[model samples]
Target: MAIRGYHAHLYFDPHEVGHARAVAEAAQAAFGCPVGHFHTAPVGPHPRGSVQLSLRPEQFAQFAAWASEGREGLTVFAHGLSGDDLADHTQYVIWFGTSEPLDLSIFG
Candidate 1:
């Protein structure tokens, strides 16, 4: 199936929220993507604090490249939006740093 878009969740610890915010804001300012709320606690399946950056498919490569270097030690959980949350989080994902275990039970 064709990807609809993408969501890149930048995960950070409570102490690293400031770093996460800077990365998210830089991404938004550079790519003009929509940055979601900075959650200081784990929400949904995310294992830690996170901020989501919604990006178009066309923006993925550039964003991913930029994030790989610009993330400043943050763990970025990025995936394709293909209308299947389970598969999107598992099969169609990439990571910039150490990957975290998501609560996939929420999908089932």
Candidate 2:
């Protein structure tokens, strides 16, 4: 099934912090993906975290571009979460791709 969009919790290194935020604001431009939700951290070790985001339908091509020219980052696995998990600060990206029926409840 072709994915309609994507929901993710993209993380970043200190240098990629501001640039990662820029990805949300300029999704179409930066990643050829649409941006949504975009809830930022209030106060904590995750001061640079953004747990809400939605990418566009053209994920393959967009990801291709990213793979070719994007910077490097880390990804946290399913068991790498801490505390609320939603706001865990792992200094890396903790996002997943979705197909058709996206269940935001899983993350909440």
Highest TM-score: which candidate? Answer: 1
lDDT of 2 by residue, 7-92 (tens): 44454445555666655455456655554443344222223434444454456445535533342343211112233444332222
Tens digits of per-residue lDDT, candidate 1, 41-66, equal 99988999999999999999999889
Q: List the residue pairs that clash in candidate 1.
A: none
- The TM-score that candidate 1 achieves is 0.97
For each candidate, what TM-score against the reference?
A: 0.97, 0.38
Candidate 1 residues lying further than 4 Å off, grouped into runs, are none
The 10-residue segment with the lowest total lDDT in model 2: 74-83
User: Candidate 2, TM-score vs. the true structure?
Assistant: 0.38
